[model samples]
Target: MNFGREAMMTSDIECDVRSLGDSGKQRAIFAHFDSLSVGQSLVLVNNRPIEHLRDAFDAEYAGSYSWQELEPRPRSWRVRIGKTASDALPRVVGHTSSGDLDRRSAVWSLPIQRRHDLDVTIVTLAPGTSTTPRPGPAVDTLVHVLAGTGTVTTELRDLDLDPGTLLWLPRHTPRSYTAGPDGLRYLRVRPHQQSPVPDSDGPW
Candidate 1:
C-alpha cells in the first residue's frame, strides 16, 4: 500500500483520487489506466467505493483488464487494475535479469505472469539463506537459475545452481533451497494451483 513514483517501464503505478472531484477523479484514473501497456497495472487508492469505476471499466473494456482488491482499510480502499492482452495476442511480460530486480530486500518474489494453467515467478534469496522444504503439488515444477548461485535439495539429491542451470522436479517431490555466498536469483515455473477463494474478484 506504500505507493511512490516509479521509473520508466516499471510494472506498476499508482493513482490517489482523494483530492479530486468526481469528474476529475474518473479522468485521472482512466488516464493512468489507459497509459499502461499490457501486463502493467495501476494501484488505485480512494476513500469511497469504486463500484462506479468498476462498472465503467466493464462497459468500456469488456474483458481486456483484470480487477483485484488488494487491501481494504477502514478509511481507504486499494485496488489493482491490470491490463491484459486479448486471448489471441501475445505480450511481453517483464525482464528477469538479475540487474532488473531490486536488491535491497533480503528475500522477495515477483509473479511474472499467470495464464490459464501456468504460473511463473521470479524469486531472490539473500546470501546463506534457506527456503523451507515442502512437498510439491500434483504438477511438475521447473526452476531456472537466472543469476547468482544456489543449491536445490530434493529428496533424491542436492543439485548445484548456476546461471544457466535448469532443474526439473516431478510432482510430489520434496524440495528446498540454500543460497550461495553471492545470493540466488531464479525463475520458477509451474502449473497454477486454484485457491479456495477466488483472487481476481472482490466485493467492489
Candidate 2:
C-alpha cells in the first residue's frame, strides 16, 4: 500500500483536544472513549500534558481503560488511551472541539482499522491531493472530518469541509475528495462486510 493508504490502518483515533477548550476538553475526551468498542483506543494529541484527563478516567472508567503516555514534552504531549474488553457497550456519542496541535502528519495518508464489527478507515490527504473515485452505500457509510479543510464532490453538488463535518455516502454512490492548502484528514466508519479478516490485517 502507498503511504497515504498505509496510515489509515492504525487503531488509534486522533483526538486533538486543543479544540475542546478547557471547559469542554474532558467531555470531548470522554466522548471519544465512549465511541470506541471494546478493545479499541483513542490517541490524544494535545498542546500540553493532561494529567487531569487521567483523573477523570479514574472516576468514570476506572479499571476499564489502560493509559500510556507516548510523548511528553515541555510544549506538547501524546497519550494512548485504550478500552479493555468489557461486558458493557460503548455509546455512539457526539463530539465537539475547536483545534489542537499545529503539525502535519509525516507518514501514512489513509489507514484501515477494524473496531469490533466496524471498519474504521482514516484518510489523510496532502494539500492538492484527491482520492480515487470511492463507491459506497448510503447510511452504512458514515464520514467524520477530523482535521484540516477540504471539498467533497458528489454527483449532486460540491461541498466545502472543515473540522467536525459529518457526511454520508449512499448506496451505488461514487464520491471524490480534495484536500485544501493545509491538507485534509477524516475518518470513515462503516459496518464490516467481509469475514475471516487476517490477524495481520486487524487494527493495531
Candidate 3:
C-alpha cells in the first residue's frame, strides 16, 4: 500500500477523481469500467467505503463484472473492479499480513491478492540469506523492492536491488537473490495468464 505511483499503474487513471466529489468519482469509475475487456480491471483507491460505486455497478454491470476488496481498512480502501464472467466470483477477498508469510530457510513470502491477470506477493529475506529462483517457463514478473537492499544475480549480469527498485523478469530467466545487511523486502507482480515457475529446489 506504500508503493509509489509508478508501482500502481492500475490506479493511475483515476489519479484525481477524489477531488471531483462523489459525482465525479462515480462518473470516472463507470467510464473506466466501460473501457475494460473481459478480463481487464481498474483499481480504485479511496479512504471510505464506496457504497455508491458498488451500488452503481450492481445496478448496471451486475452479470458481466466482479468486485473484490483488496484493502478494506479506512484509509486504504482499495477495490478491484473487473470485467469477468458473471459466474466468476471472487475466490478470496482480504489482505495478506506478515503473519501469513510462508517461512522458508532464509525468506518469508505470501500472496497479497490474485485476480484475472495479476498475482501480487510480498517477500522478506534475512540478512546474508540468498534465493535461487530457478529457471522455468511462466509469465513476466515485475518486482518492486519495498524495503532494505539486495543483489540480484542473473545469468548475464548483477543488479542492485534497493528500496523502490523495480525489475521485470521474463519467463524462464534464471536468477538468484542475496540479502544485504539490513535484510530485504519486495513485492512481486506476475501475470495471471501463466503462473510463476517455482524454484526447482522449492523456494524463490
Worst 10 residues of 3 by lDDT: 99-108
Tell me each candidate's TM-score. Answer: 0.50, 0.42, 0.45
Q: What is the lDDT of residue 91 in candidate 3?
A: 46
Cα displacement (angstroms), candidate 3, residue 38, comes to 17
Q: Model 1, 1-204: lDDT tens per residue?
A: 442332212677888998888778877987888788889988887887665778777645557898877656646777888888543244455677644222423233333222346666677777887777777666688888888887988888999998999988888788888888888888777777676644221100
By lDDT rank, best first, the candidates go 1, 2, 3
lDDT of 2 at 21: 73
Report backbone clashes per prediction.
0, 15, 0
Q: Rank all candidate structures by their TM-score, best first, as comma-separated numbers.
A: 1, 3, 2
